[model samples]
Target chain A: MFKRSVFVAAYLALSAGAAHAEFSGGVIKIGVLTDLSGTYSDISGQGSVIATQMAVEDFGAAKKGMKVEIISADHQNKGDVASSIARQWYDRDGVDAIVDLVTSSTALAVNQVAKEKNKVALVSGAASSDLTGKDCTPNTIHWAYDTWMLANGTGSAIVKTGGKTWYFITADYAFGHALERDTTAAVEKAGGKVLGSVRHPFPSSDFSSFLLQAQASKAQIIGLANAGADTTNAIKQGAEFGITRGGQNFAGLLVFITDVHALGLNTAQGLIVTTSFYWDLNDQTRAWSKRFFEKHKRMPTMVQAGVYSSVLHYLKAVEKLKADQDGAKVIAQMKAMPTDDPLFGKGRVRQDGRKIHPAYLVEVKKPAESKAPWDYYKIRTTIPADQAFRPEKEGGCPLVK
Target chain B: MNAIFGIPTQALFGQLLIGLINGSFYALLSLGLAVIFGLLNIINFAHGALYMMGAFGAYFLLTKFGIGYWWALLISPLAVGLIGVAIERLMLARLYKLDPLYGLLLTFGLALIIQGLFHNEYGSSGMSYPVPQALQGAKDVGFMFLPIYRGWVIAVSLVVCFGVWFLIEKTKLGSYLRAATENPGLVQAFGVNVPRMITLTYGFGVALAALAGVMAAPIYQVNPLMGADLIIVVFAVVVIGGMGSIMGSIVTGFGLGVIEGLTKVFYPQASNTAIFIIMVIVLMFRPAGLFGQR
Candidate 1:
């Protein structure tokens, strides 16, 4: 009778498995929304794509009873386009999570849709602190850098050096304005004075006039409160007009390793900037970066590293839950668990959805200092994870309170 | 009265000089765009890419070929112009009979392909071309320090702008080109090979952009996206200067650049939007542009 009962149970389990496979069993989709071909493309596009694939591969390309399918699209730096795509992915494509959004405008737009739909949005690129602050959403996770990170990295470090007087070349946008404002606070707190500032239009091609004004101000530090192409142009022109050699230091308040690489170390060298990760910082970073570089043919920037870590943690959450799909439950698992990934060592997700991790202050290496083409930065200092991000009490995240 | 509303005279003059330097690039790039548009009727969207290529060509020539800036300045543009000619003959020529919009679309696509290919090879990090041994230092005027490169750029752009203007306005070939633009059929009846002229005109226009790029190499890092961003502003400048007149594009380009500079000095917040503001006002007042013919 016991043998008969065991045979009946095995037959019933097989029938249940067949039914489960027939109804819903294939690939678990993760949609990657990124600025693939616009102003911020160089900073996060191709590298983020590779990072997401790496995460999928690391997960054995399957979760639960389903294979993982990574699908991505270029947001083209448009917020509405990103939102529509996110909505489509959720409604049609069965995308469980959206990862590697770079621009804050696009990230916020996607975040809203994700919250309304209850799909997970992992942001590894966009750097507005508001992602975890006033604009924080329950379903969204800000996995990478933010305005606070930039301020603390560039502002605190430079301020300590008594390079206190500042003249800002700000991009006329939210990101640029926030970076300028935050860094200004850090500068003042460190006893620096604001000399003057100029706001350049987003995607300004020529920065001669702005650099000239900055040079004339004779401020000790010229803060470039911009990112990507704008920052590259400002630094290039600054070097050209001898603004750096004119007794003023060029401070890249928000810059990426790719920007430095594009600017080359000669123009970028001696310009102090802050970042969370430099591919050459340590053995672990080197090892991880080497694999990334070999795969992508480019060094991994912090944003790329963030993608890897965010996706890895997301998968771990999925594995722990033993469910291939379910955004709410998976997100809850993610927040409840401590995060560990090859890119970000060990970190934790805060209640506010801010992933706490260490940030770095790196200087651009001179051309001679670089042994390889992609070797661009040297670690100047490491800001502890606690000190790197804005404190929970000050973060203004409703969830945190 | 001497204080001029809390702004120093020296500060104001310094800002003006800065404006002139920016204006120089504006004039050069707009002049090149106008030259190409005059004959081709297609906005060479790849103009900025060609400019970026010129800079990279100079950088590579210097680093790899042991060429100096002066030689690269002359050679890089020619090299890039030749590439432009090849592109025109092989690809752009096929699109000439279609709507002018097709030319713009084709060139825009070409720009992407060119920029993408370069970015793939070089990455986004820029390569620096050093200021030549001769142009290494700066000179102090009464108000501010003037780097030789800045002075050189301003002076050279002025000469080139006027030179191109003179060529289009006064030369026999330019007159023939203008005549062809007016009525290519009539010009062909006069036994001129209008198509060849069109090809050469495109090449010359591309060469102007490449020349500007070569001049810019020592000033800016050679990068793929350098031209992509600048070309948009140049478009705005072209609209602000009316596309009909060569001299008009030159004047409006320089003038807007100066205004953009002054905006940085006074309000600072309005600097970025100042050019667009002027563009709007020009559209409101003249509709065509400041120098544009109705």
Candidate 2:
């Protein structure tokens, strides 16, 4: 009788995934809301749209007798613009899912909008960990990397390697705060100490003054808890100020591939970074990245790779349920299934709406070591999928049982 | 082992030097705005866009044509200055007879268009232009590690700024230009082609901006939005110095850069706003600006 009961439960779970439902409007519309022309454009702009298209084509939705349409727009990295677009897409355009919000402000704003409207938000680009922590919602799945994961992977490594003291030059914003807090935790946990930190206005071009303060603190590691231009500027000026040459190093808490590319291997060499994906990771990634390169002319950043993976996974879930009627239902189903895509393989979404994937710590290659265009990093180590992100129960998400 | 306002004295000196380096950029940019506003009697909002073009111009010359930094210093300005000349002739000249607001609007629109086009091409992360081979390192000068390139920047900006100030305030041509601004009809009666003089002055002002951009390429990322970022601060410097006052713009530019640098030490959060706060104070006390004549 017990054996029969086990068999019955297994049969029911399979049937649930096989459950057939109608496709709303006879089609599934996905909106690729991204930073198209702003600072993050290079990292996650038109490239995201192309990634989504590649996913749709690779999924062969047409051959499967399902209609999947992709639409994209520039968020301009503004919260108001992103939420307004989110409302219009959900209400009027019938976009069942929005993906690749490039900046944290836009992502947080769109997350709320997605929750209210009961649509799926697969956050692929934004770095803040709050989306899956305090701000986790049933309708959103943080599909890419986040601040906590980055600090855990890159921060601990630096500390273990004798970077015992830290001083942070942070951007004065929520994203920066989260990055700084998360990094501080990781640094301390790994037996390092944080001496002091200073916050500069966001998007600040000159970092000399703030950098001097960090320098004066006599910290072994100057942690830059900022992203995009702010990080690059600080690093560049720190070089001019002899920060690195004077026996201190800068830990760029949120460095991206495009940043290394922008700084060039000459300056970015030896800088450690944590990322969820690298195009050259394996045969599968290389093959997919090659196709992406052919289309976009640039290799995929982790965010772009995540967009392809998340969009592919979202489609698979939609196709399984055969409906876009309820975004929360689809997101729940996405969580129920394990993710296996070429870019980020064999991952799973947690109950807290955080996607679980192993993140890699990579060091930027020197100029002489680079073989071709856009070839930037060499992997150092992998933080396992389970340990890569904040532990599910510790996230404080109401959704986590 | 010295301290001031709870900050170390050595670090404060480092910040002041850094501020002076950044201030050189403001002084150069504001000097151009001052000249254009004083002599041309037209506001050139395209100045920032022209500055971006200057950086891109340097980036392209080196990558595409095998040109080097010294040549870029000469070529980038000449090329951007010509574009400025064309803008003055084709668009700005017509608006000169109208409200200065028209000139401001036209150039502001042009800035948007140019910045957008460059952004589309560059993708906004920006391209790297290496520091010239000779200017690649820093020297420890007791108080701070000053990058030789920054020192070069200070010297170059100072020479060019004082050169322009002299040209405007003392030279015979500068007198004719100032006279034209006062009474163009009388200047035209004196056989001086006021329109052409106005065009050249605009070009010169723009070239000064391009010169600053070239100097900045080594220090900052050659990004599309670099000018857009600094333009507002430079404008504040001009306003605080009394818009259209050349010496005033020059002095206030360096002064505010130092003030902002001090703020960075005492209260780091207020550094970006320090210049504007000074502007607010100056405007309140003297509505015509610190040096603007009533």
Candidate 3:
């Protein structure tokens, strides 16, 4: 009688599995909203799109009896444009999730619309900590590094290394302010002092005046709390002004592999930066980045790498659920599941929607030390996953129960 | 040992030098605008775009043709100027007799197209143009470490600004250009071939802007949208200078740059808006401008 009951239970489970498969009829569509042809494009543009496609293919959704599609649009780093695209994708195009928003403002804008429309926002390119802080939502997951991660990684390491005095040349915005605030706390906690800081106009082409102020501060380290074209221009012009050779160190608080490529090893050498992923970090990263480079003609930046990891994990959750549910439910499932990917390794999403991963403190390799193309960084230290970001309890995220 | 407003003299001098360098760009760009407005009666809104093109022209010449800074300095302006002549002859001449707003709108549209094309090709991340081997280092002038190239820019700008002033104020071409500005009909009646001269004048003014662009190439990033917003600032400079007197534009460019630099030292936050504030104040006092005629 017990054996008969067991056989009946097994038959019922098989019937339910088939029913779940039938319910998931349509294709899983994802929209990649990013700066495709702007300053951040080299870091998270077509490369990001390609990475998402690779993730979709590698996941083999078709083999698992599901179809997935990826679409993309250029946000142009404008918040309004990003929000509009998100609305259209969710309301009209049946997009289940959006991924890889480059600028922080644009990412936040999309985050709100994603919340309203009940779609997932897997942010990989934007670095603002506010996504998981005051602005955190149940429908969004900040997968990559944030301003907090960068500040903790680079600022603490530099202060520990005896570069005790610092000056900041910050981009004038909420992004810059958050970075400066985070780095200052890290520096002060490590027994360092912030001598001064100057905020330059946003998207500023010339940083000479600000660099001059940083030079005059005579701080042991000049921290550049900016990114994209602003960061590149500051570094290049800083080299021209001989700011690095004048006995003061330059710290790039948030830099990407693309930036180091643009600045080249000669100008970028000896600069300290923090990142969550590097293509040559390990065997798995190398394998994945090599494949990506084949398609994009460049190695994957951390943001691009994060896009792959987040999409792969999202697909895994979808397969586990076996249906395209509302974004909040899908995200809850995502939070419940452990994130394991080749790019970022085994990770977890906090209750606050912050994806936990190890960030690295890296120094750009000098021209002579580089052995191959894209061999740009020498890892100084690894920031553990738990300490890499702000604690969930402190973020004031309403979703963190 | 010296201090101004509690900031060290060294810091003050450093910012002053930077202000002067920026002033040079303002002067050159505004000078071109004023000259073009003087003859063409239309604000050349594409001046900034042409300036950006000038920088890109230098960049392409150096990267593609193996040409160095010296050759780029000569070729970029001439190349951009010729392009400018074509624009004036082909498109701008059509709106000459219409309201000035039409010319403004037409040029503004052209600026967008040019900027869009360049942005499409280059992206917004600026490509660096290296300082020439001749002027690559800084000179320790006891007050601050003055970049040699920055000093060179100021010197060259001063010479160029004065040279243009002389050509317009004292040369034989000056009389025809001024006479054309006052009475193009009369000048044409006198057999001056005013239409061809107008085209060449636009070209000449654009060439001046291109010259500034070439000079700015090594200092700033050679990017597409570099001139889009910068043109707004130069427009502000032009308005404050009244655009009526060529000398007024040059003097106001340098003087306001100095004042803006001082504001940076005393209160860094007001640096970007200070110029616009000054523009408003000047306009309130003199509606035409500091040097503008009714």
- Model 2, A54: alpha-carbon shift in Å? 1.5
What root-mean-square deviation over C-alphas does model 1 reach?
A: 7.1
DockQ of 2: 0.66
> DockQ, in order, for the candidates?
0.42, 0.66, 0.37
Candidate with maximal DockQ = 2
Among these predicted structures, which one has the highest lDDT? Answer: 2
True contacts kept of each: 0.49, 0.79, 0.44
**Per-residue alpha-carbon lDDT of model 3 for B114-233, expressed as tens digits?**
987887666566677888999999998877788899899999999989998999999999989999888988999999999999999999999988988999988877878778858988
Q: What TM-score does chain B of candidate 1 reach?
A: 0.96
**Pairs of residues at least 3 apart in sequence or in different chains that clash in candidate 1:** A261-B125, A262-B124, A262-B125, A262-B126, A263-B125, A263-B126
Clashing pairs in 2: none
Taking all chains together, each candidate's TM-score versus the true structure is 0.90, 0.95, 0.90
Question: Candidate 3 lDDT, tens digit per residue, A256-330?
Answer: 888888777877888888999998988999999889989878888899999999999998888888766589888
Candidate 2 per-residue lDDT over residues B171-253, each given as its tens digit:
99989989999999999998999888888889989988898888888788899998898899988988888879999999988
Error of 3 at B249 (Å): 2.5
Which structure is stronger by DockQ: 1 or 3? 1
| Cα RMSD for predicted model 2 | 7.1
TM-score of chain A of 3: 0.93
Candidate 1 per-residue lDDT over residues A44-100, each given as its tens digit: 877787888887666553333435667788787778888888898888878889999
Q: Compared with the true structure, what per-residue lDDT tens digits does model 2 show for residues A1-401?
A: 00000000000112233334587776788889987766788889888988988898888776676667778888877788889888988999888999999888999999999999999999999988999999999999998899999999989999999999999998887788899999999999999999999999878988888888888899999999998888888888888878998999989988888888888888899999999888888999999999998988788898999999999999999888878889999999999999999888898999999999999999999889999987888889988998999998787899888
